[model samples]
Target: MERLSKATLPAAHTDGVTLPPSGWDTQRTGIVHMGIGAFHRAHQAVYTQDAFAATGDDRWGICGVTQRSDTVKRQLAGQDGLYGVLERAVDHTGVRVVGQVREVLFPAEQNAELMARIVDPATRVITLTVTEKGYRRNGQGGLDLADPAVAADLAGGEPVSAVGRLVRGLQARQRAGAEPITVVCCDNLASNGRVLKRLVDDFCAALGDDDLTAWIASKVTFPCTMVDRIAPATTDADWALGEQILGLHDEGLVTAELFKQWVIEDDFVAERPAWEKAGAQLTDDVEPFENMKLRILNGTHSTLAYAGALRGYPTITRTMADPELAELAAGLITEDVIPVLECPPGEDLPAYGAEVLKRFSNPALAHKTTQIAMDGSQKIPLRLLSTIRDNLAAGRNPAHAITGVAAWMAYVATPEANGLPLPIDDPMADRLAAVRGSKDALGIVENLMGIEDIFGTDLPGNTSVHDQLVDAVTALLP
Candidate 1:
């Protein structure tokens, strides 16, 4: 089969596939995106293309930067930065080819070129989807100056870390007298945009560049966002399915559920795409929406990941098939999370949670429990811990939320679950290794609760929460 590219696009089958707009090639690069992964392809990239199709905007083309590897660069570049989003729903399926990504750069080898794009005055919006660990933040939520990658970047080495690269780009932009820019964070972090701005500020302060810091303060805006889509890791079967539908081999294919959403904080320092024209919500505040998703969808996702993986389920859909696990997910949302959440306007908390559970149960999306189970240390703090802390403050015992944390403790301590090796894929795996040395459930819980980064300084001293965790971990241990 001919590869999916501009050359073959003319002859490709489009009966059920959505093609890019006719003049998509005329669009110029105006957005520089970090961490060009599957989720971004299926979520933000799709929205970007829609924005172009809606307004005929020619300045919002994307230059996608691959942070950790050249794999995505090769995959996308091989096909002229073209990729397919295979949207799967229970009753329907569709495919859309995205052409908004005009360029792909691997930062390791293309640092200069990537920096050039960031410094380009045409580029007014910089978006990031780098996962939590990519930030290299210290436990106190500031730039970790001791991080080797951060330190190397600070010492004038080739930029490596996400924050490092971003700060360096801002420095170049300032020197070049570039226009003001907006930095939108599309990650799963709490107050992601605010958090990123602080990291950038911290990076600048570390370098003792008060001038650059002041320039950034005056020129840059980081807007919080709530991005949602169930884009799972595309497998061989998915690629083959795309080939069957398009009659072209697409190496850059991503699979996702049909539902998608982007809620921005209505804050930007420069011009941006007409995203609201493409079904995005641009509001004055993103906190209510952000907190709702974090505590409900993300929090329950972590719960299901740990508990489901331990139950020998490979995928979240499969886990949801189990009545007990499904009930646990529903109960966690209704009981613990909903009570603490202030419902976003025009949204019903219970109904939204039900929709989330329905999305998870979509059989076409093979969102792996093990995949969601990765990076538990970074996720637990925002997802489960916050709910726990809130419930504690309200004088309520959040058992279900406590169980989620306990499940993570057991997951970290146990090497295998249901005869399969459960890999500890956390950045803090070395620190978490201490829990494995404990003799019993209480010992493991105690050790993990001591990790100030996740539990915080206050949660560790709460005897009620600690006792609950001990009992929950004891029950969960295999």
Candidate 2:
């Protein structure tokens, strides 16, 4: 095996393939990130690198933490925290290794060390992409204090949940009289900051301490975010293709589209890097952009995730190639979703929608519908249901969004889709099955909408929208 070293690797993809050095520095930096997934690496870390390169200030270098997966930690360490990212598009592939990641820690392997680093005053920003289910909330949408891991953590005087760890880490920071660290959530939740705030409060309250809560309320900042990028999974075939193109053995390479966007509410309490230099939009109000992206791009993605997966499609590229699937996806956006979106100033919703469809259809990406559909129950509320509710409030029915939900239900109703069992990775999977087992689709809709935590109480009572949803869903069957 060729020893992976930046010195031996090609300088750029154009000159063939190259691997980054296997001994990059792992010194501490300003940012400590949780959930070291591909999206974070290709999107946020890429942005950080751009900012660093532009500003020449390495203050925002990232130290990544993975709660469950050791794969990222081990692979990154093996490559000296230097991994390559391919900017995949319909016509091209641009490969480069991002060195912004300084170090990685697995909670299981370095719990003490991880906690200490997060609590360190040097860590100014602690960001996360740990997924929705990682929050461990209950039916009431509050933190699940009854979760076994939570129970274990509390009983053993240890922190288990991400929120728990964050709160505990903050408490340590507070005890040391450190400056406040901005806690940014890069998840797909609407009002992500507020959700994180609630989790922080719930976690602190569970500890039976008002002082800690007060300290956090006074010190920490949880800024909600809207991030966009189309990062497909790294399949074995993709690896082989990468090797064929770039004559280097890569163990931790990820493929993503060249397009990317990160919109954040400029609400951090402490000092922050000049991320604007790196193309991040730090606006006073992120609602319009958030709403637009959630509805048009993410909402349409979810629609295809279930619908295409059910119709014998594995990847978005293949699904988009199918005339019927592609037409349905486009119609769902232009006709049903676009009318409901409120774009920010200077942003063309139609143009943005067009770009999203083009990205989804990009032949080089091979983005999988199954991957997009993994956490349907958690994602539907943010991406689809919110728009449905908004449309209903405006006295307009969201037929396409409703159809997407119905397709999602149909996808969940049967484990196997076109001979393969789609991997369902949602916290409410069992509950969704129980709800779907009802007599009709309306019964399932009613049961799902009745979850006050997910939709709030106002939506389930909207009889007209309910009737319209039932009607649209009924028409979807054959």
Candidate 3:
């Protein structure tokens, strides 16, 4: 069997690979997307391929950008921009592999070239899945204008943060009198489009350049979106499977749940992909969808990630295989989560929760606890805290949400589980560790929430909330 490398690999985007006869391959790319992670490949790239297949519009093909990671650059470049998506279910893996990415840019390799690509008048859309912490935000959830890298970008007259990069790229296009571009944020953040806009505006404001901020606000359309796909971190098992099946060793291979969805605000400037034709809901508002996913899917995932890991479980599948954790998760979702969510017509939240559990419990997919647990500080507010806050405001019982919060705190306290050291990987890791050790859990909650940018003014010190969370953690302690 041939190993996975360009020399031995068959030509992709050809070779009988059933890609849609859309404008993707034939049309010049008009979209440049950042953060070439697994989620992007499995989710956004898949949708773009679907659109091309449906509309025969190749213009939506992606040019991926990575600020870091030489691994993706090497693998994608090696395979002629070919990669595989392993859609996992309980029974089998549905494999769809091809090349929808025409090119990739490594920031360290071609910073100026990357910026030029973004500024290209031909580029009509810029999308990002750069993760929550990639925003380089301050504690208050605003862009950190004081970040040295950003400052250097400003000093060197080029921006570095995702939003900053978009601003600079758009600035160049604006100076060139180019047409407006749509900036889509596909991260998990609620109202992510607005978050990107606020970050970009803040960056411009600190630069004392009203002209640039105004230009960005006027020309760029940052559309919020709800994107869902359970793409587990690929393991050696996956690579082995790929090699056995495809006669290749692909370092860039990604595995995901068979279920996938993208809900976007149907507003774009200039030309855009026919993604709506590809099963993506292009809507006037994505808030309902976003809220439902965040509170239900993400919230339940976090609960399992922390609580299950503490119980000596590793993968989400293994965790769900544990009847106690699985039942606890389902109970929390059905009794606590679903009641709060307004499911789409004909969409059953309970069924979705069951699907979530099934996806989490796929033994073939070893979605690590540490991977899900990374950036807990940045994640807690968006995933768990907001729902707790809303429930409290609405005079609803928030016991399960509080339990999730406690699990987060407990996970932080005991940084390792299942013979693995817990990943206290966050900007506030050191501080959180110190607080975790020094203060009581309640104090830790208060302190964590006290960070104005993270928890806002109202959430951290609520006496009732604090009491419930502390009590939950105390009860869960072995």
Candidate 4:
């Protein structure tokens, strides 16, 4: 099979997929995207392609920045920024060749190059899908000055993190007097836009660049977005399937669930892709949707992740296959999580919960428990904590939330119990590792909760919450 590129797209055909036109690359690179991961490829890139196809505006083509690795740059450039996203549904699979990404940049080697694009007047929109830890933010959602990566970034060397790269790019944009740009954050954090703005503000202050800080305050817009799609890390099988189905070998191939949704706060300084035409909702507020997705879908995923990992389930569908575990998640969403969520106007909260659970149980997408469980410290705060906070304030014991928390503590503290060394990947991995040697489950709870960054002061102060978490751990133990 030929490699997917401008040369091969004209002949590409699959049973259930749409291939972009050979002329798609004629579009200019007007969007600068950071953290070019599978999720971004499947979600934002797909939407951008549809927008271009709908309006024939080639100005929104994307230049993706792969933060720390040249792996994506090499793979994507090998295929001329062409990739395939196979939407794996339970009953069938669909494929589409994504072409919106016109270029890929490794900021470490090409910081100056990325800065040039970011500051270019044609680059009207900047978006990000960098995960929670990528922000290098503290518990309060501010830039963590204490972080070593952040500290090194502050020292003005080659950017090692996404936050640093953004800071540097903004600084250069300010120097060049570039026009205002909207920074859309597509992460799952609560109030993501506001959080990113805060981090940028703090970054400017730390550098003592009052002028840049003022410019950002007056000019930049960071729009919060609620993005939903289950795009798992592509396996070797997925790679082969892409070739067999599409008749093209795509090194940048990605796989995701058939379902996808993006809701953005209708706030921007300059033009953006006509994503609304591609089924996105542009609204004045993104909070209701953000809170809904975070606490319900994301919350249930974490529960399923930790619980399923403990029970020796490899994939999310395998985990959800167990009726008890499925009910536990469904019950958590319907009973504990939904009560705290303020569903948007004309939206059915319970129905949404049911749909989320149904998506979780999709057997076609191999959403790994280990992948979902990797960053518990970063995820727990947003996914489970808000509901836990609201439930406690309303005088309700949040046992379901406690189950997710308990599963994490066990997964981290007793790595050997599951027959393999847990791949602890998070900003707080070292701190968690230190407490892994704790003698008892309660000790693990006490020690981890004491880390103000993860648990916050309220959870540790509330003895009842600790007891409930302990009970959850006991229930899960074999």
Best-matching candidate per TM-score: 1
Instruction: Give the residue spans of candidate 4 off by over 4 A.
Output: 417-421, 437-439
Lowest-scoring 10 consecutive residues by lDDT in candidate 4?
414-423
Score every model by TM-score: 0.98, 0.91, 0.92, 0.97
Residue lDDT tens for model 1, 1-478:
9999999998778777989997887799999999999999999989999999999989999999999889888898889888899989999777799999999999899899988999999999999999989899899999899999999999997799999999999999999999999999999988899999999999899899999999999999999999999899999999988999888999999999999989999899899999999999998889899999988999899898888887778899998999988998998899999998888888899999999999989999899888998999999999999999889888898999999999888888888878756788988999998877354988898888888888879998999999999998888877
Candidate 3 residues 1-478, lDDT tens each? 4434445555333322333343333557678989988999999998888777777766666789986676788888866677778676667665577568888888767778877887777889999999998888887668787887777777756456676676777777778888888999999998999988888888788778888778777888889999999888888877766555555656678888878899999878678988888788888888888888888888888888888878877777777888878887887788777776777645778888887777777777788876888888788787888777777777888788888888888887775555767668887787777664433666666666566766677766577877887787776553
Taking all chains together, the TM-score of candidate 2 against the true structure is 0.91
Q: Could you tell me which 10 consecutive residues in candidate 3 have the lowest summed lDDT?
A: 11-20
Query: Can you rank all candidates by TM-score, best first?
Result: 1, 4, 3, 2
Model 3 error, position 160 (Å): 3.0
Q: Report each candidate's C-alpha RMSD, comma-separated, in the order given.
A: 1.1, 2.7, 2.7, 1.5
Question: Which candidate number maximizes lDDT?
Answer: 1
State the TM-score for model 1: 0.98
lDDT of each: 0.91, 0.77, 0.77, 0.87
For model 4, residues 1-478, the per-residue Cα lDDT tens digits are 7888887877677577688854587899999999999999999999999999988988999999998689999998878888999889879786798888999998879988999999899999999988988898877778999888889988988778777888888888889988999999998888899989999888888889999899988889998899999999999999888888888888998999989999999999888899999999999999999889999999999999888887878889999999989988988997798877798876899999989988998888898888999888999988988899999998887888888888888777766444634567877888899766454777777888888988888899898889887777767753
